[model samples]
Target: MTTHLSVRAPDRDVLSDPGYQAYLVLRVVFSVAPVVFGLDKFTGLLADWPSYLAPWINDLVPGTAQQAMYAVGVVEIVAGIVVAVAPRFGGLLVAAWLAGIIVNLLTIPDFYDVALRDAGLLAGAVALSRLAVRYRSVQRERGSVA
Candidate 1:
């Protein structure tokens, strides 16, 4: 007697999968939003970016708050690029960055509502990280011969 083992094809289309779709949406949003916001830091078209900096944090860093914002803009641009190229790590990077922002906002009495919004963003970042982990493993498995 011979026994047959069945294996599913590795080339299955994942675009239709709900999880993959969610992952793609999140990846794109995370990739774009940060870069746009980062650019705005220099242009100040959105808001006075430096004014959002907590005084304590400003004192801790050298130079003025605006200078710090310039540095932040660079970091944000880099982070967005990372998310675009390698979301598996980028998601965590964004989450960590958001955590810092949350702490900074909490220090400012007038920005609690903004902090709350950032907290929501932090959660989304965390979710993206988790989803990235799942999809990354799936991709690796799909690339390998079964």
Candidate 2:
């Protein structure tokens, strides 16, 4: 009897699989959540937010919390849009920004919960970045430039 040999290769269509769909959902949620929070900065939906900054942020900015909030709102909205649409560079930007937020949250003892929440979000950002890169690479390999 002749010897038999088998070689296994990766599934090329993995990017189009249901797992990728889940990734898309998670990415969209992560992107949109920031937009909502960013808008709230302008609207002051969280009654405690301004007061929470009454001690430190005010001293740092000096009569400029509202202006600073507006700037942050604009940036967050733009970043959210980028993540939802562009994905590639957007993911990188989101991940970097989230890292900064996480770092800041860690400095405040009362914000430990927020810090933990951001840690989870940071993981999601990383996952989205990987998914975007993987999908792009797969498309390129398959000769379908997207």
Candidate 3:
């Protein structure tokens, strides 16, 4: 029986090494920042995160705005972990999440600027995702874990 090696014969992947470094930086920031913010959600040490929720949303929620934010925090924590585990797709998830936040802020009064800022972050997240795909592809070609 011929035991064929099914794995792709991989060599070193040096394409866009510098660019991959940028991807790594973005991955770390996006991954760790959410965990930090999610933890802060429980303590409310950074800011009154729930207060930022639109008044209408606060009313729509079953519980206090704080409780809604706790849920948001949980989602953020999971998203952050996802980014750490799978940045290629996770960055896109974060970007989508930011787009939703931006939309929410746009619905609220006097938060257009914050929404725009988040839009910028969303762009960064997109770039990170694209770059990460290339980086991950390289890692796979190299037959190594990043």
Best by lDDT: 1
Q: Can you write out model 1's per-residue Cα lDDT over 2-107, one digit (the tens) per residue?
A: 9965555435576578888888888999999999999988999999999899999999999999999999999999999998888878989999999999999999
Q: In angstroms, give how far residue 74 of model 2 lies from its true place.
A: 1.0
Residue pairs clashing, model 3: none
- Candidate 3 has an lDDT of 0.84
Query: Which 10-residue window of candidate 3 scores lowest in summed lDDT?
Result: 7-16
24 in model 2: Cα distance from truth in Å? Answer: 0.6
Where's the lowest-lDDT run of ten residues in candidate 2? 47-56
Over 4 Å off, model 1: 1-13, 144-146
How would you order the candidates by TM-score, starting with the best? 1, 3, 2
Clashes per candidate, residues 3 or more apart or on different chains: 0, 0, 0
C-alpha lDDT score of every prediction, in listed order: 0.87, 0.72, 0.84
Q: Candidate 3 lDDT, tens digit per residue, 1-146?
A: 88864554334346346787688789999999888988888999998897679887788879998999899899889989999999888899999999888878998888899899999989988998898888777777677665
